[model samples]
Target: MGWLAAGADHEVRLDAGRVVARNRQGRVLRSVPKAVRETEAYLELRQLHEWLVRHETACREQVEQWLVRSLPVPTALIVEVWADEAWRAPLRDLVVMPVDDAGRWDTDRAGLLRDADVDKGLGVVDLDGETGRLTSTQIVLPHPVRLPDLTDLREFATDLGVKQGTRQLFREVWTRPDDADARRRELTRYAAAHYRELRHLQARATAAGYRVQGGTATVKIWEDGVPVVASVWIGEGDPAWETETGPLGFTDPAGGPVRPDDVGPVAWSEGMRMAAALHAGRVIAEDEESA
Candidate 1:
């Protein structure tokens, strides 16, 4: 972006989401002069940087939502957003597979996204280390949990030396166990985690993108196209007081308890993921440390 004049001697422009200033001699300044900072050009650049930061975050979150939902994304949409760096960054190198009209994935057509061209097609690098363009109009970026031979894909990704902007290939996954009793306890495996303070736990949950309600840290997932809410009981009362987390559980849209068997693969994985993230922040007490 061209530098905008700040008064007569100073000029300012955005540099990697920051407002930077330069002298009239065209020498870059180490710091934005205090006087120039108050100029309209500096303030506008600062405001633009803030909006860009928010746009980047929103773009990444939207891509994550697509991965979690396994939604079919049209190439046209990709083409439209490809020019925007905020959207391009998160969508880069993600595994994508062509989807049939009936919403079925063609595993053989799976590849790592590289480029999107409106006139040509979606460009990708397949599993065998071949680069090509997928002419399919719509494609699904399958979640790691749904991919076949996930171990092979991980090894392949490692070989390609490609880093995915969105968490997919290397993301942790969990599957519902076959035994009924095991399924029942699947959601509760991370229970009894300890935190020094309720506020700390609440803050952790919020930072992890989970909602902290009155007495629970919750995450809602759309499994099988139905809303499934998973919650972990974080004791209520004074936020600064010490607290312990309770068992994780899931409920339907109506707030009715969802049966363990009824919880689908995606819901089970996501519910466990939420609990595990919170549990990771748990503090081991003195006595427990000795034990």
Candidate 2:
């Protein structure tokens, strides 16, 4: 039988071989008859919940990649994705800019997209601190390019009480430790004593969007218009099934060592983050024993 109304504010369904009753908030009111738990409705609900979890994870990962790479996205694509309930939740209320047909972005056209309408197009709150609908045919998801007038834009956004749906691009970044010795010590503190297999470490680094080369994991970032590369040495394993990691290194585009004080904040933090992640993945002797 289908779900039956047991009370004005409760519902009963056979779920996982049990007859369960729940309130509007999905709180369990009661459960009985273990046989009802295998009902189709119960199984369907469980499957839907699992699918939603995966969908949400996918959405967040995709969006984060765009933010990290500062890649440009098309407005129509955003509108298309917004139609899906699963995608809409993560994308709704994000700051967007309408690109002109000539491939130019005017910060004046930038606004928080409140809603997507089939007939009227996008509802946006513009930079002038005005709320209106924009029917532009095309727009671009701008790269997090540093702008000269960003301070004024931030103040305007603050006045309008705008909260970005995603991480802000070109946000003010912090500086890291200036002392090379101190920075080196901090970076290597998490080095694993036991070697992690080279293949395993490579897989982890690749999955994390880092370049794995010659037994090292490298992350590249731009600092002060200069390219800096941070590398962690995940060495080739020995015949006895052991591998080792060396100290973290930072270098400039010209392959010269960069002092910690010279590294930009974003590069420093990202480089350290990569090192920590690799360290965490190290296969310690204790972990092997526990396994």
lDDT, each prediction: 0.88, 0.65
TM-score of 2: 0.54
Q: What are the TM-scores, per candidate, against the unseen true structure?
A: 0.95, 0.54
Model 1 Cα lDDT, one tens digit per residue, 1-291: 999999989989888768888998999999999999999988888888888899999999999988888878887898899999899999999999888889888999888999999888899988888999988879987777888968888888999897999999998899889999988776678889988799999999999999988799888887646789988998889988888888889898778999888888887888889989888899977897799
lDDT, candidate 2, at 51: 75
- Model 2: number of clashes? 7
TM-score, model 1 to reference: 0.95
* Model 2 regions more than 4 Å off: 1-20, 23-27, 30-34, 143-149, 153-161, 169-291
Candidate 1 lDDT for residue 262: 84
lDDT of 2 by residue, 213-264 (tens): 7767898775544679988887754434566666777998677998777776
In model 2, the worst 10-residue window by lDDT is 139-148
lDDT of 2: 0.65
